[model samples]
Target: MKICAIRAFTPLTAALGLTLLLLSFGPASSSTGWLLAQDEAPMRGDKKVLTIDDYAKWRSVGQTSISPDGRWVTYAYSRREVDDSLFIKEIDGGDPAVVVRGSNPEFSKDSRWVAYYINPPEQEDGGGRGMREAGTMPTDLHA
Candidate 1:
């Protein structure tokens, strides 16, 4: 499995982790085809970012990213329900914990800030009218 980012460059589709348009990278001595799917991260000093085996560990729909210091990983778990609810798990030395839930989860560049989408569910009224649910911030986790 080659490490490549999704190269469609389009919003493409909204199918859980399939929505990701990642940048793929290749090693030296490779000069055949154009880089597809995703682009490679530009880094120096002979440090490899991630390997194919690591990426295979998690399911595709959920997005995963290595921490800046490479200590922990923050990713979304997208198969909680039939509707594909999201969950953020902080994997460290021990068990991972649920950090948040929703769609399109992301972390800020500094890794201090984070963002996600909140598709509020519609509420039904006794009168048969329905309304979309409002977005709310997480109340039960550290930020």
Candidate 2:
């Protein structure tokens, strides 16, 4: 009876060990799914093949902040290697104008004001300057 029990337990233990071994290596095999998808075409009809120049011309928007009333939005827009600019737009529909040469835009709690930090350009003396040091920081807040 003892020998019969040992034979049953041995097969069960081996199967459990094999399952754990396969699970341990699961992530490495599953990561290849992304590689398989890379060769597939995009799901848009009007999409064209992207090139390096297209990336350079790409305008990226970042870190959008909406007003409390939901009527306005402030965000940063930038081109490749170019200066980032802050912009505010009405949600109802209006042209977005550049508020300042800055990023990380924020809106006031009252939804009446927008603010952003102006990053100083590199100085010729290889030093950095703050907004005050650069003189006349342009802010969207009036008052």
What lDDT does each candidate get? 0.38, 0.49
How big is the RMSD of model 2? Answer: 21.1
- Per-residue accuracy of model 2 over 30-86 as CA lDDT, tens digit each: 212111112223335665454454455445455565565666665665556566667
What local lDDT does model 2 show for residue 34? 15
Clash count of each predicted structure: 16, 0
The TM-score values for the models, in the order shown, are 0.35, 0.50
RMSD of each: 15.7, 21.1
Give lDDT tens digits, candidate 1, residues 1-143.
12234545443222212322221112321222222212243446774354553333222345554333333344554322223344443433433444333555555445443455655543354353234333323322454
| Residue 57, candidate 1: C-alpha displacement in angstroms | 20
How does candidate 1 score on lDDT?
0.38
- 131 Cα displacement, candidate 1 (Å): 9.9
